[model samples]
Target: MSESTNLREPHAQLVMAHGWLLRGRIWQPLQQQLEPQWSCWAPDLPGFGSAQRPPGLSPTLPAYGRWLAQEAKQRAAGVPLVLLGHSLGGSVVLHAAALLGDQLQGIVLLGCGGGVYQRRPFARLRQVGCALSWFQGDRRAARGLLLNSTQRRAVAGLPKLVSQLAMPSLWIGGGNDQVMQPVYVRHLAGYAPDHQIEVLPGAGHLPMRDQPAALAEVLIPWLQRLASPRS
Candidate 1:
């Protein structure tokens, strides 16, 4: 799923990961905007969309992180690689960062944060997510992802992962995002040693889809900085 146009040689590679009960196709709008400049691939994570989970792959965040890292390795084509994740996808990106090491240029997170575990809220989320997935995505994938969000290891490890990030990162939040409020986004950004946070005043959970140009306005400049030749 390389979505780059052949109009020009791409300067970098981007891998887009989607959130729970969502497929990679959700990134199409943003991919179109990035165009020939960025060689972008948005794969449906296993158990979501048309992808099937490998025989032994479990429905854990770490397992998905490994899969994402391998996917990026294959698609990198010796160019700078950046991972962009939305919501739950951001958690996956954090898990894969250390594994990608120096090959990873940077990371962009949208509507994703919160290492704190709220028991009742998480339990309610699992139930609501599972119910909604039956209509929007794979029931199995939704169940596993919802379960992962509630696990001690996944929730507790997020802050450490954010704090340990060696590469610079950008975290974006929607001012009206009820799903993951801007507060959580700022909260997590505080942990990273090198990070920038942006909030789109009119956007919500799915900014890439709802506000592509606005999202791009915040994204393109940061990407330019990353793609710049290091002295």
Candidate 2:
């Protein structure tokens, strides 16, 4: 995990999880926009960016969830934390929530959700993933991440995780996100006990890069609301 360079006293710690095949630094623009107010930490998950996959670390969501939960806890040092995850990372957060318990103040899911496994869509996704792996830079971590995402059990377990969530949550979808459509986002949000949903118009899958300010605009007010009672 890495910390924001800014020195201001943070309102709360924000730990961001990157999507599959992406590195922690991908959150740079969003972190920059949120800095001074939020103490942002974006870790390069094993096998991506500068991090190496540990010898026994599996490619499944539960394993990754354990890894993230530990990392978030150590970094937080008892401070309240808000977990923000994008795409596959959102699924990871769902798995980690139960493990985090009270240390987690809230969760934010961006461009991620799926309770039902559409065989055709998943097949197509695997096909695209194969092509990307073959043509793009070779990273063993990419293969593992893709494997977890396409698995039926993993995708099907998302709703159960959401249903079990005891903390507040915010689910956001890109108006133009063809990858994880608004329909899926809404579907998953329905399972949450306490949740709010929002859409960023004209933004696609990578809104952190394409619409950082807009995403932050939605996040700030929500974080403030969560902080009130604790304050």
Candidate 3:
């Protein structure tokens, strides 16, 4: 068994990006599981949680992508960080990785991956996601984000980015996830080299909320892998 790490004074920083319409605090359970080994900081994606979409900034894919990379850099303070992002945030992190260059140590994509969405279900999700955001009072931001996301053609570029990556990558999914199903997660593994993939048994789309312990059960081992030198 691996030894437990101290909660305070973590050895490495873990910059977490939560899913759309979700706040950073959702990562609290997983952060606890990662304590001592990783100092975790989960940031609210713009238009979600306490963050607001700035004027003239459309909540498109690129917009969130830019915000995340900048936020992670500022928060890390010159220290390289491991980026862990969930759902839509998962997609944002990959785009951000392109700009981060070598400062990014690694990436862990949770409950998200690239693949063609099965039309109807995805449309339903878009409707629900957009409605929820509007109800929350960020109509324009939510609508724009949802519109851009529904264009599945953009998915093709997702794998290409992972293929061209400079560091390690890990992809995880909840076994029972209805959104961005595990099969899509499997699709990502096809493109990424040295990519690690795991599925938390019986978990759903929001594993960080539903099965954080199980999410962490496999998560710690993967973090340990980051410590070992890779060829």
Top candidate (lDDT): 1
What is the C-alpha local distance difference test score of each model?
Answer: 0.88, 0.88, 0.79
Q: After superposition, which runs of candidate 1 have C-alpha atoms over 4 Å from their true positions?
A: 1-7, 136-138
Give lDDT tens digits, candidate 2, residues 15-92: 999998788998999999998778999998887777888878887788888999999999999899899999989988
Sorted on lDDT, best first, the list reads: 1, 2, 3
| Number of the top-ranking candidate, with TM-score as the measure | 1
Q: Candidate 1 — which pairs collide? A: none
Shift in Å, residue 168, candidate 2: 0.5
**TM-score preference between candidates 1 and 3, better one:** 1
Counting only residues 3 or more apart in sequence or on different chains, how many pairs clash (N, Cα, C under 3 Å) in candidate 2? 0
lDDT of 3 at 210: 78
The sequence of per-residue lDDT tens digits that candidate 3 reaches over residues 1-231 is 334434344545788888877789999888777776678898766767777778867778777788878888888888777898898788888788888877888889998886565688778878787768766457787677776877776666777877887888888988888876788899986688768889888889888887888888887877777765679
- Cα distance off (Å), candidate 2, residue 67: 0.3
Clashes per model (N, Cα, C within 3 A): 0, 0, 1
- Could you estimate the TM-score for every candidate? 0.93, 0.92, 0.89
